[model samples]
Target: MRIVVLGAGESGSGAAVLAKVKGFEVFVSDMSAIKDKYKELLAKYDISWEENQHTKELILNADEVIKSPGIPNTAPIIRELEELGTPIISEIEFAGRYTNATMVCITGSNGKTTTTSLIYHIFQSAGLNVGLAGNIGRSLALQVAEENHDYYVIELSSFQLDNMYNFRANIAVLMNITPDHLDRYDHNMQNYVDAKFRITQNQTPEDAFIFWNDDPIIKRELDKHGIQAHLYPFAAMKEQGAIAYVEDNEVVINEPIAFNMEQEKLALTGTHNLYNSLAAGLSANLAGITKEDIRKALSDFKGVEHRLEKVARVRGIEFINDSKATNVNSCWYALQSMPTKTVLIVGGTDKGNDYTEIADLVREKCRGLVFLGVDNSKLHTFFDSFGLPIVDVKSMKDAVAEAYKMAEKGDTVLLSPCCASFDLFKNYEDRGNQFKEYVRKL
Candidate 1:
């Protein structure tokens, strides 16, 4: 069989290599120029590929196509592929068909990476042979091609979930869904929520669905579409029969098995992370991981890059790089986690943001606001009524320095841009690395 892979980036290139390893005739094509590193890999594998253009003649002859999550379904080429009755699937779906491993898929607007990592840490601590892939590290296709594992902990984005149809998750986690990437969903909240809900699309009664019980959006959706999987809801407040709940300072998970621990001792704090920890704990319990291992992993897991990461304490000023908080909801969580007065460095490529959701939190926690994007007019218009000190800066370094100057000794400099980094940086990682580099210069 012949396979065509679209978008010659990490996901696409990984898919091409895996297809070749599986003895399929693989051809890769990208509308944009392919990087030298990936080009070299294609050469090493003796796979055929082209960059800067897409040849319909070659792509149409394929048995199937593996598309990168970054490419939207509305692209002309994709539409053409669809018109031709070609089956195009995501890297995650393509990879899943090749493995019998128990899949633990995590998806939501925010906290997905942290929860996926926490679950992976718990399983690893239990000495389980598990592979971490999808959105975080290596592509799932590449991992499924080279290594054999008993389980996989995958971080699923809405884009990735869009192309997945028949893939089933033995354990599925839905963190709180909020308005994120609405542009891809025609600026509709239900459309975006439906994309996140796709993680549970193919699950059965035997599978487990873990969710945040406190998120009203999730509850509303659950009421609309009753799930077939066993429901496990985790919440900060007490719930009558929830599998996971917090009482006083301790978190308790009942049902299939009972496990309880102190909330204050959790490695990740804040109400947002409390939900993340709860989701992870419930997933670990379902996997038969011992409570001791879960407790150790939850207490010792450091964190992922660019998401509420503590950079350094220079001159008694704490600098935090939360560049992964790309959407307004993510920034709200970051702001909610701050303990002292914050010099908030926000603003980037706006994704139809509703800043009003975090307006009250800003009024309560922020000392000064630093807008770090090309355009700050919308932000100014929104927060002007709040009557806070706001400064507009052109670069990350300027923003950091300005924030540092405005901040007191006990204050925090938070680089939690509640928007995409495409305006000034390649991606969130570049934005986060620049923030860390600027902070280290202090």
Candidate 2:
């Protein structure tokens, strides 16, 4: 079989290696320059590849193509491939064909990374042979090619889900759906929601689907689709028969095995994280992990970095890097978790964000606002009437400096840009590392 993998980044490079190991003729092509690390991997595997441009002849001749999630269907080359009747699938889809591991896939607009990590921790604590892959750790394809595990906890984004057709999750987790990456969905909320719902696709009755029961959007769409998987609804409030819920300051899980833990015992706090913890607990339970192990893992698991990570406490002021809060809803969660007066660092590449969702939270928690992006006009116009002091900074260093100046000794400085990092940094990780670097310099 001839396999052409597009985008020689983490996912593509890994997929190419897996294909080669599986005895397929493999080629990797990336329009942008391939990172040196991935270039080395391709050569190490003796796989053919091209960078900086897509060779039409080489790519079109493939029997199947594994596409990276970053490349949208709107690309002309992708459109041409569709017209040529070539089958294209995501790396996850291609990798799924080679693994017999029980797939525990998590997807949603927010809290996916946290939930994925938490579930992996729970499985590990239970002494299960598990691999962490997808959007969080090593690429799934690479892990499938190199490691042997009984299960995989994958973090799936909507873009990754779009190209996944036959891959089925033994246990699927859907964190609450919100307006995110609407531009990629053609500015349609339903389109984005539909993409997220694809996580449950191809599942049978034996499979389990865990989701937020309180989200109005999720509830509204549940009636429209007939899902075969067993439903496990989790909520902050107590439900009569919910698989997971908060009751009397404790999170309780009732199905598969009855378990409860003190709410304060959770390593991750905040309303959003409560839901995340519940989803992870339920997934662990469904996987047959003991209740005691789940509780222990939940209490000790450190949270994902760049998602409200506490960087340092300088001069009695706390610095938090929440650069992964790249959407408005994520920023809302970060703001909701702040217990003290906050000097908020926000702004980046806007994705038609509606800031009104966080307006009330901002008014109540924020002492001042610092705009850290290429343009801050939209933020300025929106918050102008609020009568709060707002400052604009052109770089991460200046933003951290300005925020520190505005913050009082008892206040918190948060770098939770409610937008993408493409405007100023390479990615959210880069934006977050720079924030921590600048904050430590103080």
Candidate 3:
């Protein structure tokens, strides 16, 4: 079968390699220049690929297409495929067909990365053969091709979940659904929510579906979507059916064998991280990991990069890099964790963000605001009347410098941007790395 892979980055190249390994004719095309690392990897496999252009003649003849999660469905080629009735699937979906391994899939507007990483650490530390893939480590397709493991812990974005069909998660986790990437979902909250709910699409009664029990959206959606999978709901405090909950300052998992750990001793702290730890704990316990092993892993896990990473203390001022908080709810979590007044660095490609979610937090915790993006008009429109001193800058360097100048000795300079970073940076990692490099100099 002739398989065409679109957007030859990590996802596309991996899918191409996997298709080749499976003895299929695979062609990779990226409209932008492919990275040298991916180019080399593709060449090493003796697979054919093209960069800086997508040849319609080459792509349209595909038996199927594996699309990179970064590419939207509105892309001309994707639209063409839809019109032709040609099946297009995500790299995750294609990879799932070739592996019978247990899939522990995670998705949400926030906390998926940290939760995915924590669960992976638990499983790996418990002496289980596991591969970290999807949105975190290597692409699932590449891992499926080159390695054999009994389980894969995957982090799914709504974009990755969109093209997925027939891919069932042995264990599915929806951290919490908020208004995120609405720009890609026709600026509709329901559309984005529907895309996230796709994580549970193909599950059966034997499969497990984990979620935040307290999320109003999840609660509302649960009433509408009839899920066959066994429900494992978690929350900060115990409710009617929360399988995992906090009690007397102890994190507790009731089912899959009772488990508890001191909440204060958890390596990750903060209200948001409490939920992350709860989800990870439940996932670990369900995998038959010993309670002691789960506890140790949870206590020692350092945390994910760019999601509230500490940069440095400059002249008694703390600089935090939270570039991974790419939505209003994420920034709310970041600000909610602040111990002192903050000079908030926020702004980017507006993803139809409603700043009101973090408005109260901004008023309470932020001493000033740094608008760091190509366009800060939307940020200005909402935050302008908040009466905080606002500074606008296009580059991370200037943004950091201005934020530093505004911050006092005890205040924090937090780069908790609540929108996509495409306007002034490559991606969140690039934005975070730059924030750290510039911060270290101060």
- The Cα local distance difference test for each model comes to 0.91, 0.94, 0.93
lDDT per residue as tens, model 3, 59-138: 99999999998899999999998999999999999999999999999999999999999999999989999999988899
lDDT of 1 by residue, 1-442 (tens): 9999998887888888889998999999999999999999888889999988999999988889999999998999999989989999998888888999999999999999999999999999899999998889788887888899999999999999999999999999999899989888889989989889998887899999999887889888896666789998888888755779888789888857889998887999888888989999999999998899999999998888899999999899999999999999999989988899998999999988999889999999999999999999999999978888899998999998899999999999999899999999999999999999999998
TM-score order of candidates, top first: 3, 2, 1
TM-score of each: 0.97, 0.98, 0.99
Ranking by lDDT: 2, 3, 1
lDDT of 1 at 91: 89
Single out the weakest 10-residue window by summed lDDT for candidate 2. Answer: 235-244
Which window of 10 residues has the lowest lDDT sum in candidate 3?
219-228
What is the lDDT for 42 in model 2?
A: 94
* Total clashes in model 1, counting residue pairs 3 or more apart in sequence or in different chains: 0
Model 3 regions lying over 4 Å from their true place: none
